[model samples]
Target: MKNVVSYLFLLFILGACSSTKEKTGTSQAEAIEQQTIRKIDVHAHYRYARPYLSSFFQDWIMQAVLVDVAKEDSTGINRSWKQYVDMDIENPGVFYLCSSLVGVGIDDPDFATKNIERLKNEIATGAKMVKVWKNFGMVTKDGSGQFIQIDDARLQPVWDFLKENGIPVMAHIGEPVQAWRPLDNPMNPHYEYYKNNPQYHAFAHPEIPSYETIIAARDRWIAANPDLPILCAHMGSMSHNVDMVAERLDKYPNMMVEPAARFGDLASQNSDKVKAFFVKYQDRIMFGTDFGNYDPAVDWTAEQLDAEQKDLDATYNDLWRYLSTTDSLVIRKQHTRGLGLPREVLEKVYFQNASNFLGLE
Candidate 1:
């Protein structure tokens, strides 16, 4: 009887030891997943046929030039995103999808009412945020043929709905400062684009609107609707000058800037100053690639798709290195070094700030 009792006691001890080991292993896995979750790209353009998507996407298109799929089909985009998410669900942080709204009939009297209902439906369907593009200030016009500034009173209902629902608006209000500069200027990152798409060049059409005018309209909107959250894309459209962007950040408490496709703009500045700017306002900036997937106008072969995936991997790594290291890199033809930000600051820029701002976490 004594021998039997001793053996049972030994078994109990061994069982406890095994359970502790398993718990430790699970915790280590969770920590590693958290690191991946720390990085989030707040801005990118993705097209899908579906109007509604869930709050979290498996693959968040770190960057795509363009993606063209059917207007009614969400399968392609959903599958791509799911594959990305499946990579490491335990980590629980990768990308949050923000869906866009089509401006099919802004001139109609029912536009706002219909869109408001649509926006509510989208939010119910899992959209985390809303995006309003440059068309508002650049191409869209009022009934009188005057360009519709972002602050146009006609859109008050939409703004009110967003404000009431606490849905942040990711607004790209105007073209980059380069759009107003001479097309021949080599310093302009958009030189090639403007050269090929001259219709968007502000230099060619003096009657359209001035940079200051557009900016003024955007600022006025922010001021008028102080409670509404705004995510200003492309460094608030002043990437050419960080000081100006900083000034606006200081002025607008409800605004945050996402640096997308403007790495060159920051790279051209003094690295120390730029790094300091990031560190100071870490909570107010987001890392975005502005990667888009547009329809290439032809059926993409498997090889073409593979090449694009390769390009995406390289681009994502490039931005990561720039933000998290001090190594020098040639970004957009400019030789610049990385910011080597601390882990805390990286946490904020990569994901924490976004989560807090969007109320996802």
Candidate 2:
């Protein structure tokens, strides 16, 4: 009976959010409109499965023009994000976070420059967005082995190009807090990669900037280009600090955030706080299920799902079950579980906020 009631309620909400032009402009209608969930999934990778995708298929993209709908379907990875563009027009559902690539870090900025030229020439053809991944911190290096953070002057042209094209860039800068070290702390989880792949751990002069420094650089980049709107990934690199994230969002009119993979922990810890954060900043939040990238061969089999679920399940468990529980679990990607978010706020966090940010109808 409880399950049935919940199902009915969910259906009701889905129905209310489905309509576009309202018939009667009643208060209920207005509330429904405001509450309606539209989503622009500002994250998800596209790859050329024709060649290089079988590897990163479990976790990233490989580069491709288009993917056959049937060939490499990732709906299991993102059940809510099907028909990437159709989601925007049909319902207040998940829209596409279309992104473009420019260069191969500082190593090939010349190539990146020419590549971007090609991109510019073809921007009108369907490149609706730009998503610069953590390539800067991971890729840029000088002869002295100095790393080029996102705000590096050489990359200014990259930012300028996006601004000129009128496409907002979702720049995911900085490695997560624990990507640099391997010690088990209350803040992070255990990962086997750091134990073996010493390179993944920042051993030498970390081309990858520190968490604080990277956020600073990212914020500075955003601040300098007031006109170039950037939806900073993982909460402006302050996913670790909700208060500061709120502060930054308040400060940057041109800035926004997407809850890519932090949903479970934050919602589990303080559901009410997460709810309040969303209600207060509903206009600024965008929904992003950090799925895609399924290299089944490299990642794991059913055996690894338990560990993986700690991270992936947080988005759902936190989004839905958070209304009731505050108990923490081992959340994914090395984050300590538990961030208790509210029900209504979860709805906004799930999709509505995303829709508004992307201007999806």
Which has the greatest TM-score?
1
lDDT of 2: 0.53
Kindly list the per-residue Cα lDDT of model 2 for residues 162-202, writing each as its tens digit.
77767777767765555665456534432454555455455
- Against the reference, the lDDT scores of all candidates come to 0.70, 0.53
Q: Write candidate 1's Cα lDDT for 272-323 as tens digits.
A: 9999999989989987777745554266676766566657645766776677
Give per-residue lDDT, candidate 2, residue 65: 17
Which sections of candidate 2 miss by over 4 Å?
A: 1-36, 46-97, 102-113, 185-198, 203-208, 293-318, 323-348
For model 2, the run of ten residues with the poorest summed lDDT: 62-71
